[model samples]
Target: MGKSKVYFTNMHATIKENLPQKLRRLIKTAGIGQIDFDRKFTAIKIHFGEPGNLAYLRPNYAKTVADVVKELGGKPFLTDCNTLYVGGRKNALDHLSSAYVNGFSLLSTGCHIIIADGLKGTDEALVPVKNGEYVKEAKIGQAVMDADVFISLSHFKGHESTGFGGTLKNIGMGCGSRAGKMEMHSSGKPHVSHSKCVGCGTCIKNCAHDAITLKDHKATIDHNKCVGCGRCIGVCPMDAVQPASDESNDILNKKIAEYSAAVLYGRPNFHISLVIDVSPYCDCHSENDIPIVPDVGMFASFDPVALDVACADAVNRQSVIKGSILEKNGHKHQDYFTDVSPETNWRVAIDHAVKLNLGNKEYELITI
Candidate 1:
């Protein structure tokens, strides 16, 4: 495959051209206008930061993307699926509240915020993964799959699990329904944490397969009956049902690639990643640590894999920020992501994405 063109722009802004305007220029130069968005529903996928974590991309950035989509006669909405973990964004109501608290109101973004997976994180579309190894059918949020065009407005930053959350991570993991996330994170089904279970039987009511039953007032999953659809996890009121994080990091990464393919297949998709705030952990956390490196810049591409590789390369070239996690951890691997998260190998996702023909790893970085 030929090297995909990834457009880049530094943080430096002139007096006349500010950061958001520069971002608009970057995407336009990157050929986002190539897609015909006449009256189409465009899902601008983004992470509305968890309630207290300030590392997430601001609503202004989302507005820029939304405004561009509107300019092309597309109906745009900011979107993200409910998170798997217990946090501010676990369900749609809480997730919307969190987004609003974090400044992602309709007024702020110039687009409505849709919690993709519906109220309980159960609303989903079963999308078949082409040439998939780990997943045959991916469970993505219904709203995301229903979109006419998909655009990822991602915040490129450190992730504890995937090594770094970029375009693929944002699309794959972010677009997945609750069940989809459980599949990517675990090889096995979720188990009820007896300590957290209140014997409410909410899981049993929601289970379509009769896989869950109350044993001595605590819910227990019958593995034989359970299809690992992760419905029980979403319904458990006390957060008793916990997905097993047994999948190897490499396998998890590959599965994420497959999921990404499922989301973007046969669709008009564009990705933009802002490599700023460079936090040590995901925005899923309520607290964000200092950046591990200086703010890199904004990047846009039609190719998610190449976009991620270019962002990683840009981040690696920067000097580690003093007193941040990367510096404190001693940069042992010479790769900043690995130095901070030694257990994760982000290359697995890129390699699998390449094998899946999602995008080329080689890219021509064109500065705007």
Candidate 2:
């Protein structure tokens, strides 16, 4: 495959052109208009800031993307699926509340917000993965799969498990339903934490496979009957049920690539990643640490893989911020992400995504 085109524009703004206007120019120059979006439901996948995390992309940027989609005759909506871990966004009602708290209302973004997975994070569509290694069918949010066109507007940042969360991470893990997220993060099924259990019987009532039984005033899971749908993890009031997040980082990365394939295959998709904030942890966290590096710029591409690679390269070239996590880690490895998160290898996702024919690793950065 040939080198894919990745458009870039530095954060520097002039008096004549503001940041939002610049983002509009950047994505349009990156060939966003090439897609046919006439009267189609275009899903602008985004991360609404988790309550108290200030590093997430502002709603103004989402409005810029939505405006461009409207100009192309698409019906646009901002969206994201419920998270697997316990947080402010575990379910739709709380998810919308968090988004509203972060200023993502229809008035701000010029688009409605859709929690891709339904009320309890169970509404999903099973999509069969072609040439899949680990997953046979990927469970994705029903609303994401129902869209005619998909666009990822992601905040590029560090993650404890996956090094840096970029386009692939945004689309793959972010689009997953509760069960799909469970499958990517764990090789084993969830287990009950006996010490934390209050015998509330919530897990027993929620388990569809008859996997739970209360004994000695605590809950126990029958592994033989458990299908690992992850509903118990969400419904437990005491937070006693725990997902075994024991998957190796490499395997977790590859699984993310497969899930991304499930989301983007046979669809018109565009990707944009903002390499700002450079936080040392995911936006899923309620708080964000100081940025590890100076803000780079905004990037857009038709190819998710190349877009991520370009973003990673841009981040690696910056000087580490004093007192940030990267500086404290002492840059042990050549890669800044690895130096920050020694256990993770972000390349695994990029390699697997290439093998899946998502996009070429080689890219031509077009400065607009």
Candidate 3:
């Protein structure tokens, strides 16, 4: 009902202070611990970098937040949903391996990793959002919906589609199961390319409702049986499955907002975004481009929308890296995401999320 506060701190460190302490202070000052955490199942939603992408957040930062939650008697687990596209993180085992390889280990962060979607990325809970745009309920991963509290630790970086992946992006899309992600990213149907299908039956095995079948030495999808959950896309050994149309970037962004609304329903949530690496693409890529700007520090807020807006505003104020993605246009007087991906306008997600009553767009930036 009142102005939301987004706590921030720059990369300023002197003899009397350090960045890690500053991060904890930012979380505390944002009132994340005000929620009851005793014996609660807390899900710290985060992206465990695709192995080989070195731009992800260090596990030590996760440890800091884990300590805070543990002190409050909450059972915290670092979690993320399975990917929509085929990759090393398509299933729980490979996903966990990628997570640990990326430095999110029990020894590193003092928490276990859980792929929010089940083994094949089918575990989900349909959360009904009675809104004009979304029509019905959004299907989110079961573990995320089952959690008593939600904490989104986002790596704020440039995205190919959404312009940026901030707090809302981290929770909304990041919390979705592979099918949920497919729903957000595209409107067209998903299909399995028979040419690429090796008859391996990987997709058939993973399909929850037997929507995929092998016919004439190839895999075929029965759209009637298929709920478009996207598991087949991720599990195809031959990389056969694909979304029909990539969907418009604006619709993709709006879907992301709807997914975020599903994630915030009836839960105590805290969000932290680290605007570092400043890469031009998502960490889903195996490679990361050079940083497009200096490392902006951490931000925390109870209001995910305000937190994202503050992070974007902070990134926009920085100068672009000399030879990075933003250098091509001589550092346009706008956010680097728009400069690099002109086709994408990241603000649409923020505006739409605000319209959904997720949180306010206007926020007071408090430098902690």
Q: Count the backbone clashes (under 3 Å) in each candidate.
A: 0, 0, 1
**Residue 364 accuracy (lDDT) in model 1:** 99
TM-score of each: 0.98, 0.98, 0.95
- Error in Å for residue 294 of model 1: 0.6
> Can you give the lDDT of residue 81 in candidate 2?
92
Error of 3 at 289 (Å): 0.5
Q: How well is each residue in 1-368 modelled by candidate 1, as lDDT tens digits?
A: 78999999999999999999999999999999999999999999999999889999999999999999999999999999998888999889999999999999989989999999998888999999989999999999999999999999999999988999999999999999998999999878889889999999888998899988888998899999998877777777788899888998899899999999999999899999999999999999999999999999999999999999999999999999999999899986878999889999999999999999999999999997
lDDT of 2: 0.95
Worst ten in a row by lDDT for model 1: 228-237
Which digits, one per residue and each the tens of the lDDT, describe model 3 over residues 98-201? 98888888899998888899887888988877472852678799999999999999999998888987888888888888778888877756997777878888
Looking at model 3, residue 67 earns an lDDT score of: 82
Model 1 ranges with Cα > 4 A deviation: none
The C-alpha local distance difference test score for the whole of candidate 3 amounts to 0.85
The TM-score of predicted model 1 comes to 0.98
User: Considering every candidate listed, which one attains the maximal lDDT?
Assistant: 2
